[model samples]
Target: MQIEGSVAFVTGANRGLGRAFVQALQSRGATKVYAGVRNPDRLTLSGVVPMRFDLTEPASIAAAAQHCRDVTLLINNAALGKVNVGALDTAFIDLSREMFETNFYGTVRSCQAFAPAIVGNRPSAIMNVLSDATWFARPMVSAYSATKSAAWSYTNALRVELRETDTQVVGLHVGFIDTDMARDIDAVKSSPDFVAHVALDGLARGDEEVLADEQSRLVKRTLSTEDGYYLDPPPLV
Candidate 1:
């Protein structure tokens, strides 16, 4: 779980939180970092190597896993986040499936492909970027929340499954991040750098789940309450 001298592969590392994760790894003294993105040409980051990885494509993920076989830290930061899309709308099923493809299935695929390597590496870590939405329902971005919820479930299961190994699985849950994905939202958002640092620190300390922000911590704390956030959720739209 130590960041120093580690080898990492971060999905969706072109911009936003993914980019932040790559930069954070570099600053934390990771020996090597692979920035996984669909188009390698778009990766202008200085320190990390650009990797051709498309989450929706099984072959692309397999190739990246093969290439980055030495990766000790796998950060599942790539996700399809769609806002202002109603869950019951006509385009609901299509968009929902697309999000599921990348956010749920893609994440699981990446984990499966790299798990063997991670187990071999030992003292490694897998950080799954989740959201506070995993604990609550927002009608505006219901599908996105659904995908995060599924990821959160998978992360927990993966953690339990890897309990005996030296490979630590940490789930990072946070509120809106100050990235392009939440640009149109009118609310205070956590900077990507801050969230990335929090996640890295959590991994260093061997935390199973990281609530990176106040909103995430509060939401998680109240999940067991009778009148939890999910009971009467915000009209995010």
Candidate 2:
């Protein structure tokens, strides 16, 4: 669907990749952009409406969907990546559960809550900000990868379910983004603005899946190889 004049709603719009998404939408001529954040007061972007939204809270998501009924585009950019995800030891269960709540479950909640509005507004779309980790596993981020894997699969299913409607479903895969989420990670990273623009471009082009960076592209290309990148993947950097 065309982004110009589209009404878009983005979750976790307070900062990082979510902030980039909001900016890109504005530059692309979106008529109205809703920034979904737990604390609307923290939003600094002007001319954009802010709504209280917390992925872990079903009530907040439902309320945002009800209030932002004009939203023709839904961008699931909110996620929990850093906290407790780098370890899978004694506290693995707790850490993994928390990440899943905000990553997988939260995204699913956003999709479910906003489907009615998106469908009613035909010519709409849903873009889920996914990760390259969906296809590989790393010890430090195994739990995190698991969450993204679940989300990635769900995105595919969602696309199939929405095939008959005018609403499009797209999944964006990328390596570490140069955002606060990867503030300390010592690895090559894609610029948030760059990835955000690529994602919007893919959405406009009606692509069901978009690889935002070379690392992601390479990783996907090796998925079917004899060694299979997942078995012992090369360094993304």
Candidate 3:
């Protein structure tokens, strides 16, 4: 899908990678961009329409889908990640459930709600923002990782289901990014602008999956190796 003259709707567009997506889409000549957010007041970006979209709320999702019927590119970029120290503890379980609510089920809801519009348009696309956590687990972020894994599986399934349609389903995975979500993590983080550029480029080229950084590419390569990264949970260092 060419970004030029396309109408896009991006969730969590107020900040982070979502914001980068909005900017990139505009820069690439998207005719219109809908910035989906829980609170429309928070959207300060110009040249994009702000819509009230809360992924956890069915009504909000439905409303946004109804309002943005012209959208050809659906960017499911909103997600939740809360770190928990103990993977087996009740706190971890609760947080994991919350993460899944946003990362997994939310993506599903958005796809279902927007399918009609996307399918109505030819050569449309859905870009799901995933993570390296989908392929590996860290003790501190086990819950978040599990949610991403579920999302990855869902993205795969959705891709196969939509194979006959004009809509393309694409999954994007990357390691830590230079965003508020990784503010406390002291590590090499990819620039959100660069990741967004790679993602859109992949979509235009009809790539099914895009690894936005070296870490993500490395992790994907190791998935088939003996004693792969997913086999053992890594320490939180």
- Backbone clashes for every candidate come to 0, 0, 0
lDDT of 3 by residue, 1-237 (tens): 899999999999999999999999999999999999999986799999999999899899999999899999999999997788766767987888888899999999999999999989868999899999899888788899899999999999999989789779999999999999999888789998999999999999999999999888888988899977778745545
C-alpha lDDT (0 to 100) for residue 177 of candidate 2: 92
Badly placed stretches (over 4 Å) of model 1 are none
Q: Write the per-residue lDDT of candidate 1 for residues 1-237, one digit (tens) a residue.
A: 899999999999999999999999999999999999999997899988899998899999999999898999999999988864566788878888999999999999999999999989989999999999998877788888889999999999999999799889999999999999999888779999999999999999989999999999888888899988777876654
Q: Candidate 1 clashing pairs?
A: none
lDDT of each: 0.92, 0.91, 0.92
Better of 1 and 2 by TM-score: 1
lDDT of 3: 0.92
- Weakest 10 consecutive residues, lDDT, candidate 1? 83-92
Q: How well is each residue in 74-143 modelled by candidate 2, as lDDT tens digits?
A: 9999999853434547777777899999999999999999999999998999999899999998777888
**TM-score against native, each model:** 0.97, 0.96, 0.97
Candidate numbers sorted by TM-score from highest down:
1, 3, 2
Where in model 2 is the C-alpha error above 4 Å? 83-88, 234-237
